[model samples]
Target: MNGDDLTKEELLSRFLQLEQRVEELEQELTQKNKRIEEQNEQIEELEARLRKYENPHTPPSKRRSATPRSPTSDSDEDDDNVRTDGGTPGRNDGHDPEWRTVSDPDEEVEVTCDCCPECGEDLDESVGVSPRLVEEIPDPQPPVVTRYNRHCYECESCGTATVASHPDCPDEGQFGVNVIAQAALSRYEQRLPYRKIADRFEQLCGLELSGASAWHATERAARAGRCEYEQIRRHIQDADVVHVDETGVKRDGDQAWIWTFRTAEHTLYAVRESRGHDVPAEVLGEDFAGTVVCDGWTAYPAFTSNLQRCWAHLLREAEDVADDHKKGERIHRSLRQMYVGLQAWLETDPTVRERAQMHRSARAELTSLVERSETDGAVATLLGKIEGGLDHWLTFVGEPAVSPTNNAAENALREPVVLRKIIGTLRNDHGMFVHETLLSLLATWRQQGRNPYEELKRVARDNEMISRAQAVPVVEPSG
Candidate 1:
C-alpha cells in the first residue's frame, strides 16, 4: 500500500508541472500574436497615407502669377465707367479702359529722307534703306582655322631650346577645338561610345575621326576640365549627408568598380581598379566627417561620422533569414509592419514636424516591441540586430528637413549601373574617368537646379579659353 500511494502522488505532481508550463507558453504566444496584429494594422494605415500623398493626379501647390489680368467683355463696361469718371468717379477721363496692354519693344530709330525737293515729293528709297536678301545659304559657314607656330631657339651657353605653349589645347596633338568639344560633349552629354561618336563625326562633318582619336579627344577634355571635377569633389566633401553606392564596371578587359558619392549639393564619382575599402577611402577618405547612409558594406563604416544602414538592404536580409529559418518569419513580419508604421508616421500627420518628438515616439514603440521579442527564440535574432541599430533607424527623423530615404544616390547609381551593364564598362581607365567625370558634372549641375546642356553651352561659349569652341545651337533636323 505505501509504494502504490507514493507512485500515484509523484505522477500527479509531474502532470501539474507540465500543465503550468503549457499555460505560460500559451500566454506568451497570445501576447506576441496581439503585437503582430497591431503592427499589421499600423502598416495598412500607413500604406493608405502614402498612397494619398503619392497620388500623381493630385495637383501641385498652386501659385498666383504676377501677370496683370486681362479685362473681359463683362469687366470692360465697368472699367470704361471708371475711366469716364475722370480717373475718379462720374467724370470722363478720355482714356480707353478697354485698351490694356504690356510692351516688349525693340530698339527704334527714325531717319529723315530728302528727295525731289523741287517736285515736293519724298523719295521712296532712302540712304538708310532696308536690305534685300536675294539668296539664303542654309548651311552658312566653315570654321576658321587658327595656327600657332612654336619657335625653338638654342642658347650657345646652356644649349636649351624654348617654345611657346598654347593654353587651351594639349601639348601632344593638333586636334581641332570643335573636334575636341564635339567628342567630349558626345561622350559626356550624349553618352555615345567612342566608335559611334567617331562614326557620327565622319557622317556629319566629313571628317575621318578614328575611335582612338575620339578617345584621345575625350581624355584631353577630361584633363583640361580637371578643375571642374575638383570643384565637384570639394563640394561633395563639404556636404552634410552623403549617399554612396557602387556598381561593377569593366575596364581594359578586367573587372572594375565605379563608386559614386553624392549629396544634396553635388555628386562625384570615381572609377577604381578595385572594389575594396580603398575606393571609399579615396572617395570619402580616412577623415571624412559627414553622415553616410549606405548599404551594409564594411568599407563605409571606417570614415563616416555616422553610419545609417539602408532600410531596403535590411529588408532583404530579413526576408532571407525568414526563408532560411521558419522561426524568423515573425521578425520579418514585424519589420514589414514597422516600415508601414514609419510611412504613416511620416506622411499622415503634417502637424508633427518636430524631429525630437518623432524620434522619441519611434524609439519608445521600437523599444517596447524589442523587449517583448526576447522569448520568441530564433525569430528574435533578426529583431535584436534591428533593435541594436535603432539609433541609426531614427537618424532620418533627426533631420526633419532631409528626406528619410537614400533614394537620391541610389537613383544616381542606377544610370551608371545600366550603362555598365549595357556598354560593359569602359575599355580602359581613360574611358572610366571620362564617363564618371561627365556624369558627375551633369548630375551636380542638375542637382544645383540648372540646365546641364545650357550650363555646358555657357561654359563652352563664355569660357572660350577653356572650351575653345563657340556655343552652337543644338537642333535636330526637321523630319
Candidate 2:
C-alpha cells in the first residue's frame, strides 16, 4: 500500500477517480443554485399577488377576506364581548313613546266603535278621544302647458322688426324652466340616469319626456349655472385652506379624472381629461397662495408648495404595512399616537408660538422615525412615502386654518363616485361639462344652506330674462 510499492497504472487510476468526484460535486452545486433561483422567482410572484390584497390604496370593499382563525383556550373570554344574540330584545324601560302631533288638523274624523271587541255589547258614546296625526303627501298634479303668441311689430321710423317677450315663455326651448331645473336636480342630486329621470317624470307628473330630452334639459341648466360655477372656482382660488382630491372616471370610453376642491363654505368639482398638475394649476392658478390639504399624489406638490399631507391616508398606509411586518406595527402605532396627540393639542387652541414649537418637535420626531433602518420591504416603502413628504406632514400643526386630513374633499367625492358606478361613463365632452357644472352648483348651494331646487329655478329664470333681452333686435339710427 506504500507509494514505492504502487505501480504507475494504479496511481493514474486513482487520480482519474478523484477528478471524477470533483466534476460530480460541481454538477450538483449548479442544480442546487438553479432550484434556489426558481424558488426566489416564485416568492416574488407571491408577494406581488399579496400586494393587491394588502396595499394601502386598495379599499376595504375591494380587499380579500382574511383567513378565519381557530378558537383558542381564551375563546370564551373573547365571546364575552361578542353579542351572540342581536342586542337587547326590546326597548328599554322609562323611555317615553314619541309621535308627531299636528296642532291644527287639515281634516278630522271621529272614530266611535259601534260594539265592543270582546263581547257583542253596543257602544254609542265615546268616553275619551286620543288624537294621532298622520302626515302624507298629496297626489302629484300634472304639469301645466302654456302657449304664448309672441307678437311681432315693425318700428315706424327705422322699419326694424321687434318681438314682444313674456316671462312665462322661454326664448328657445320647448320645456319650461321648472322642467329643466327638475331634470338637472334629478340627474345630479338624485344621481339618476337620464332614462330613469324621464320615466320618473312620466310616472310622477304624467309628462311625456324622452331620455334625450332629459339630457338636453340638464345641458341647459348647466349653461345657465356656468357663471355660478365660475364664481365657485374663483372662491376656491381665494380660500385660505382648501382640501383637494381626485378620482378616476371614464368619458367616452377614455380615462378621465374628477377633481374636487372644497372649503368650509363651498365645494367645486372639475371633470378633466388629465389628472396632471395642469388641472390644479388651471383651477387654483399657478400663483395660489393658499395651503392645500391633500394626499401624497405627486401632482399636488407640483401645483403648490403649501400643503398639509393627509394624516388619515398616511395612517391607512401604515396600517396596511402593519398587517404583515412587526416593524410596520410599531410605525403604525407611533403615527396613530402622534395624530391623536396633535388633535388633542389642537383642541386646546394653542397659540401661534406654541404651534411653531409643536411643529418643530413633530418634524424632529418624524425625522428620527424615518432615520431608523427598515429591512422589510413593506416598512421601507411606507417610510419612503413619509420621508418624501417630510416637510408637508407638519404644515397643519403650524397653520390654524388648515386641517390635518383631506376628509372634506374625500367626502365630497363619495356622491360623484356613486354616480360614476351607476353610470359607467359620461357619453361625450358635453356630458362632462354638464356633470362638472351642475354638480358644482348643487354642492355649492347645499353647502351655502340654500334649497338647490329653488336656486336652480332662480337661475333658470335669470337665464330666460337674459335670453329674451338679447333676442330683441335693435336697429341703429339711419344716417
lDDT of each: 0.68, 0.88
The residue ranges of model 2 lying beyond 4 angstroms of the native Cα positions read: 1-54, 58-104, 111-124, 472-479
lDDT for each residue of candidate 2 in 282-333, tens digit (9 for 90 to 100): 9999889999999999999988899999988899899988987888988999
Q: For every model shown, what is its TM-score relative to the native structure?
A: 0.57, 0.80
* lDDT by residue (tens digit), candidate 1, 370-429: 776454554576677677677676677666444555667677886686667667757766
Q: List the residue pairs that clash in candidate 2.
A: none
After best superposition, candidate 2 residue 315: deviation in angstroms? 0.8
Model 1 root mean square deviation, Cα atoms: 20.6
* Residue-level lDDT for 377 in candidate 2: 88
- Reference-based lDDT, residue 99, model 2: 70
lDDT at 181, model 2: 91
